[model samples]
Target chain A: MVAALRERVRLACSWCENAIGFIQESRLPNGARRVGAGTMAFRMFIIGLVLVGSLAAAPAAWAYSESDPSANPDIDPSDCESCHTGTPEIAGTEEARQGPHANYSATSRSCYACHQVHQAYADGYLLMPGATTTETCELCHDGTGGKGVYGALEARGLAVASQHRTEVTTQIPGGDEATGGMATAALSGYQGTLSCGDCHSPHGGGTVEPFTTDRSRIETDVAGFFSNQLLRRAPTGATYEIGVYGSDWCAACHSGRASGVHDLINHPVDTSATVGPTAFTYESVQVVDGVDSPQTVQGSLGRSNFGYVMPWPRTAGQGTHAPVCQQCHEDGRSVGDVASGRIKASEVFTVTSADGGTAGDNPRFQNFPHESYVENLLIESYDDLCSNCHHPNQLP
Target chain B: MTPDAAVTPVNSRMRIRRSMQILSAVLLVVLLVLLVLLFRELLTGAPEYPVSQEGIRPLHVILGPGVGNRPFFDGPMGVTFGADGRIYVADSGNHRVVVFDSEGEYLFQFGGLGVGKPAAGIEPSWKPGLFNYPTDICSDDVGNIYVADFRNDQIQVFDADGDFLRVFPDRNEPLGRGASGQDGAGIAVTSLTVHGERVYATDTYQVAVFSTEGELLDQFGRPGAEPGDLDHPNGIAVGAPSVVVVSNSNRNQVLAFAPGGRFMWSFGKPLGNDLAGLSGELELPRGLTIMDDGTVLVADALADSIVRLTLAGEFDGRFGTRGAAPGQFNAPMDVDEADNRLAIAEKGNDRVQVIVIED
Candidate 1:
């Protein structure tokens, strides 16, 4: 036995010595290992060299952790606060503190729960397990799996596109072909699965804000008023009294639209009066409505719709600005009346199509205070009224 | 000198005999050592696996899209080794069992998509044979093959050569407790280690264990994100002492369990290497088998590679790259280890690839 062991050791030593000699001979004037560029041939060579050995002998030495508790750390929102301070702190503000993501367990928010790091099994953007498929997010958003709050919309079945295609399977469009529909248009090219972060984000955009015209290239801010949350340093300290400027928040995905943002008026700057009125009337204000909002103008976000009390406040980059969902949905206090106190309201709009015709005089709605009288305006309680206007079945 | 040698003959003879015995013993010991080394190298690849490069001989085989006497069923689900040393393929597409020898020869076939017992007008090629999309297959110590009839949601047992051996428990009884139907799949018999005398299977939705008579013993691994959770557990294997290995494909990882389904450890990743963004690397690492040397081999389908991992969850390197070459595979699904050869059931290409471990 000792003789055999000795012989094995000698052989191994000789092999090692031979390898060392090869390495030495391969070295150039510089001391670094001569790693070639990333090419198929290079990769094949590396793989071949590594595989030229007996695997059954010692098994693999690389780590195999199907049950790696360490792989997924018990995420602490506070840990994220270091770089994500402004938003969460803003969310922590009195107006947005009660949302499920803000109040749930530290890691329970749809953000961390779904966006995992190092998801080798998933597509791009390391999605969490089960989250590998967009259906994973749909499990909660779609009605089929868990009781998804958004799933309630599917029950209405107004041509609701499968979340699968809108988020997972498809790629985000870019450049000239990049129709910013993912954010504003109801339909999507994404075919695999959908995740909450696909539409919303704790970081607003990503490393860089999406629609900022400013070349400074700052992280998308999802704080302050809806119009500026996802755009550049959200207009320092601009405050609104009547309503959020819609065009300022529509550009996140509606880059090609006349307004270059998301709102009823294609160019809010050019058609401001048309979008916002002294007495917010539905028929006049709804010209700004896009293809996604099927609920008509007269009944557009009627009193029954959440938009009645808290309208779908425009996000930053509406015309050339990037606005996050939180800009309009999470902010509980109206920019104009901070002292008026917090009002628990929603921002999802459900505007109907214009007239009976598929495209008859784009849905019109009165903006701000209006002299016109639409019975839909008197419904009261946006929570109840909004469902009528934006209810999934209400789509054109 | 001659006179002295003659006087002490008895002692001299005894000394010579003792020396001979010692020499023989030493030789025997050396021989045993050599044999041990050979077996260890062949199995463990030991100290360092696949001890030598000269010993490895890789082969790739494909099995279904449309060859063989009868093509695969709608779903080509699971494959397992029968006790009689035969490979039983659950040809879910054809709704039958495709039996083959270790050498890749198709011996005979049986069963078909049906709604009756194994013997009632069963046809190997037609529907009505008493089988419905057999998703998975397994074998016991006695050489009995258990087929997981997915659509019908039952386990049908068959003998060595392809004879029906009555379904263990009643077919009507829910095999996987919580997830009793379609999604409730992934079944296996627990060795004495996990439950003393019980059978274990995962509903893919929930985990359940049954007795020899097919009675429910215990259930665990609920579907959730918490520890001891199973998103989509597809395969399982019994390990030394009382460890159970469960493969959760959705999560792209594996879970180890104690005898009573207590959490042990988890490791592994998606099997595929394509980073095209659809999923992880361990792209559906389906089948798992523990060699006698305690090494584990995983057949990662999407990556089109056969991975060798240590019991402790370590990458021991891999064989079979991506391709249809002699040692490459498109989607190598399942594999079994016996003697010194690895019998891999390659699903995409349609034949079993054999790899010999020369270490």
Candidate 2:
């Protein structure tokens, strides 16, 4: 298309030259008398004027940088700087929240990344430069766009591959809000697609709390960071409160997996895992190189100190209950790939302490539906995830 | 030269010369036109074109400015423009009324249960200055705010400055439920709007238009799915088409009535089939505002948008989407327009989205 435009411009210029040459081919009434040089030059000038006017009518002929947005200057910061702060203060002094959508971008923070600033066209929600939430995100998230590793479009598109059906165009934000299920739980045909905004807040820029300990804190503490996808409603350790927060955020639609009502998955979630009696916790055996030693222990239902935090759900109170979805179901196809200058980038990530000190590392699971995990596999088998709480016996 | 070649007639030669000149002029004009046409299309069209031609666009959003971060909103139920032109919102979940300037900037708020802090949990309050789930809000002639203090079951009045003025009916239950829905049986004032001399209200199933002095000026409409019959009528507004009420029945429609308590017209039956409502289609229509131009804007919760219609119930346009973005809404419950600025109250998002309506 660009080449065609350039060629068309050349053709218009040639046509203009032809018109000027036409006046030059004039003849006087007497066979041999030629028109005066001055008169002939003036006529050529008139042809030139017509040619310039034609070009003006179609600006694309000469305005080469029209399609490139970069040809324009950056949006002046003073336009929005009077209100939004570049650096926002978070709850903790060191855990600076950095306002919203401020940090994490290596590129210039030219407010132009998402906002059109002046002649914005999207129909609200700060939707500029694009139409839907998906389009706005795709501005930089598509593979060719921002290389957004966890692109919103891919999530909705990969729904048929055992990924959760986010293609449904229905608004079940906190799930069904009643009997839990997809938007099509009752009505069929069209439903609202579970777009990126459904789970993550685009403007969600705040301190990242690794895991939930208190049931109340779950209401706050939305998106973690940029490289790490933003999760607006990270679950709590307590019972899933409908549409509120915690485990219920997921149970809102997956009520079939919730406690009490979930008859299919008989091993109810949010149920006590320490019901039977054990002699000072379950005594187990271990062996030394040369001597046989029986290691005895107190029964701790949901304690994880086995060299790892054990990819599992947050525990309420002292951690004694059936596993929440987060316990086994995690995000990201695999652990984050190792980055340069730091430690291995698998599940573990770099961390900074409240005093601005460097903490060794923190683990995170990201952009899931990893490999065959969504449909055919699990992070770890049920035996490994459950043995931490329930010690079962073989049925006779 | 003419004397040398006399084979052609002089008259014929003159005519031929004129024809050739005209042809050359026509060809030159045609060439110029083609050049301009090609030039326009050869280039990429205008980089930034309008995405929508809707008269209104989102300007700002007011997320519940909580008190010390205790999380203030469970549902910001209703919104309206006070005579002072300030934005008044019914923060029902916290049993309070929060006020903001025309720009939606939080100014001051009054009336609430308990300490009025949502994080501390709610406490029942029937005092004149306090309330219990103040749902619908509106203002009278002199910028005096009237809130339907749900559990308190009274029309609590206040001045523009958020100061307590007085309580209607003075008694605990003088604010009748109206007829059956108004008999003070098992209901509170469901909806409220201000007209010429009276404040029109709804109570589960009935309509109450009262004088600013708390006198019940008139009562009309009933519970049903037919014309003028309001089943589960939760919203009310008076416009050129008379009294318009939104019914939350299985039929899911809006009914209008003449000022004399007679049926006029109705729209939205069994609810519009689509969430994005085409033309007059609607999802869950809630609070409505009558634009000065005689158009109606109704809040459709499930669709997460505002559906606009003509006074005659014809679809005009729609705005908004389902999200927490500036213009997006999460279950918008009510909307009010004043001086081209629209203040939208959202139940799910717990905030009021403000947009400037373009003429």
Docking class of 2: incorrect
Error of 1 at B247 (Å): 1.6
lDDT of 2 by residue, B1-359 (tens): 57646755755665555555554455456656766565555554322222332455776667665454434555677888888778888987667788778766777777657321111133422456887656678887789888876544457778899888776643323334333211222235656887777778765456777777778767776544346665445567888645554434223466677786787666775421122212225555667878888888888764567888788877777786444445666667788888888888887666787886554
Give candidate 2 regions above 4 Å deviation.
A1-396, B1-55, B66-72, B114-124, B169-187, B241-250, B271-280
Model 1 has fnat of 0.00
Instruction: Report per-candidate DockQ.
Output: 0.02, 0.01
Summarize candidate 1's per-residue lDDT along B114-153 as a digit string, tens digits: 6422222333222333565455577776776766664454
Candidate 1 docking class: incorrect
Please report the candidate that would top lDDT against the real structure. Answer: 2
The candidate scoring highest on TM-score is 1
Deviation in Å, model 1, residue B279 alpha carbon? 12
DockQ of 2: 0.01
> Which parts of model 1 have CA positions greater than 4 angstroms off?
A1-396, B1-56, B59-77, B114-132, B168-177, B183-198, B269-283
CA error at residue B188 for candidate 1, angstroms: 12
